[model samples]
Target: MGSEKQGFIWLSGLLFLNIFVLSTADVHYYEFSLQESPFTKLCSTKIILTLNGSFPGPEIRVRRGDTVFVNVHNQGNHAVSLKWEGVKGSIDGSNELIQPGRNFTYKIELKDEIGTLRWHATSAWAAATVHGAFVILPVATEDYPFPAPTSDQTIILGEWFREELTEANQTITPGSADAYTINGHPGETYGCSNDTTFEMQVDYEGLYLVGVINAVANETMVFDIENHRLTIVGQNGTYTNRSFTNSLTLAPGQVIDVLLLPNQNVGHYYITARSSSGTHITNGILRYTTTTTSF
Candidate 1:
């Protein structure tokens, strides 16, 4: 992933792609509905706007050079704006407001781009829940720039607030979240979250591709897993010289791709995250598959 400025919008009933001219490329189409969903966290249930009823939403997966068309239905009470400033092709997929009950479509071309990126609401506090990963895999003719892992997962780090979202038109300030979350759970470290903490089940010696995104409202997060080394292969969508580290510092909206090879004893380990300068901690569990020891 490198420079990505070629994303364009196809307006319905107004603008359309010249299908005849670009019929050879693959097209990926998706529908996203911004609906009101009840979200309960830290022992309180509140109504929040979500994409397809999911806090972290869904991944927009496509191959390099493929075109993606996302048709968004804004069913929430507030207007929405989505932004995706990705790599290499720099597909700055920023759009004007899609008012309540209105629908719009977004066209993104991932030409010459590969790796991890993201899209999130840019209007007021909508991004707190309406966000997801945008992944561009290598084109059909090419393989990954690095060794392919046996499995893959996406870890989205986000902040949570206990305060009920204000008016739909108001921007709720994220003044030091009530807790941080991994893939939507506040982990088990918080009160009333023990049973809901996210978990990763892995083989004892599996090699995995882990995509980490710092989606905290406004904080830099440091992420680490106990007894495991994160072999960073890419940062912000571009491949980098392989580097190993125990802790990774990620600014808001930054993405990291790492290879996690579990070589420790087959039990459980802790995947932890916290603000770079905060006292609170969030933790997820990494459990290795269990089996008879052939004793």
Candidate 2:
């Protein structure tokens, strides 16, 4: 994908993409510092656990058959464990809890599996914000089953809480999210967020691969661009027969790869994400290269 930036989780659906060139498979190394960071959203500021202080943590990209070793240092107050979704369960202690001030190294074997996958804290409380993308490129002899995109982007779908969700665990039931986000912003739909809204621009009639991950704690969200349609091309770790639809609905921790064509009139389009029930809503902007008007 082009850029997932460093902020934003997918509000409803991820909307764009690309893949990495393959090379000889080898071992890759990474480090993660799990700590608490404060963020202000939906008119409230709260401390949440984050990896290296970034929400939607850093993305891990690799080729199939490569091995990965991630060194995780737990600096936050809580114990946590991480899992590479869609892959075999955590390996070499990656699934074991990293207690506060302790460290652990994870070994991952990226076998023949391909496509977009995700990683997140296995703890219910810490999972609220600790996660990122895992992309596996096919080896030297393989290519995507569909058209290569002219451009690429990633959308991370996630929920936001005004209070520390972990703190709410003391209650009989945890609270629902206050707002959904795309790329970390609520997209001008909530209080104090006009300037923080997330947006994406596209070339008229350009073909785009949109990588999307639903990191929401416990909600299924629907994503779409007003008056536009997308073709579902891949999901989890498998590419499938192309299916066309206007919106994407994803459950928590689910991921999907879709192709989008901005073939409508040149202007700003609302990239809308909402609960499947349509009760809660948020948005991002999808504008054309020469866009000058909005409705």
Per-model TM-score versus the true fold: 0.86, 0.84
**Clashes in each model (backbone N, CA, C under 3 Å)?**
10, 14
lDDT of 1 by residue, 1-295 (tens): 1223223332331233333223446899999999999988888888988899998988998876688889999999888878885644444435588899999888787655567888899864778788899887665555666777788888999877777564453564444578888999888888684337879998877789898998876788999988999899887766788999998999888999999988888889999999877856899999999533545
Q: Which candidate is the best by TM-score?
A: 1
How well does candidate 2 match the true structure in TM-score terms? Answer: 0.84
Model 1: worst 10 consecutive residues (lDDT sum): 1-10
Instruction: Tell me the whole-model lDDT of each prediction, alpha carbons only.
Output: 0.79, 0.79
Q: Write the per-residue lDDT of candidate 2 for residues 125-165, one digit (tens) a residue.
A: 67778888898766656577888778777888877777666
Error (Å) of candidate 1 at residue 62 is 1.2
RMSD of each candidate relative to the true structure? 7.7, 10.3
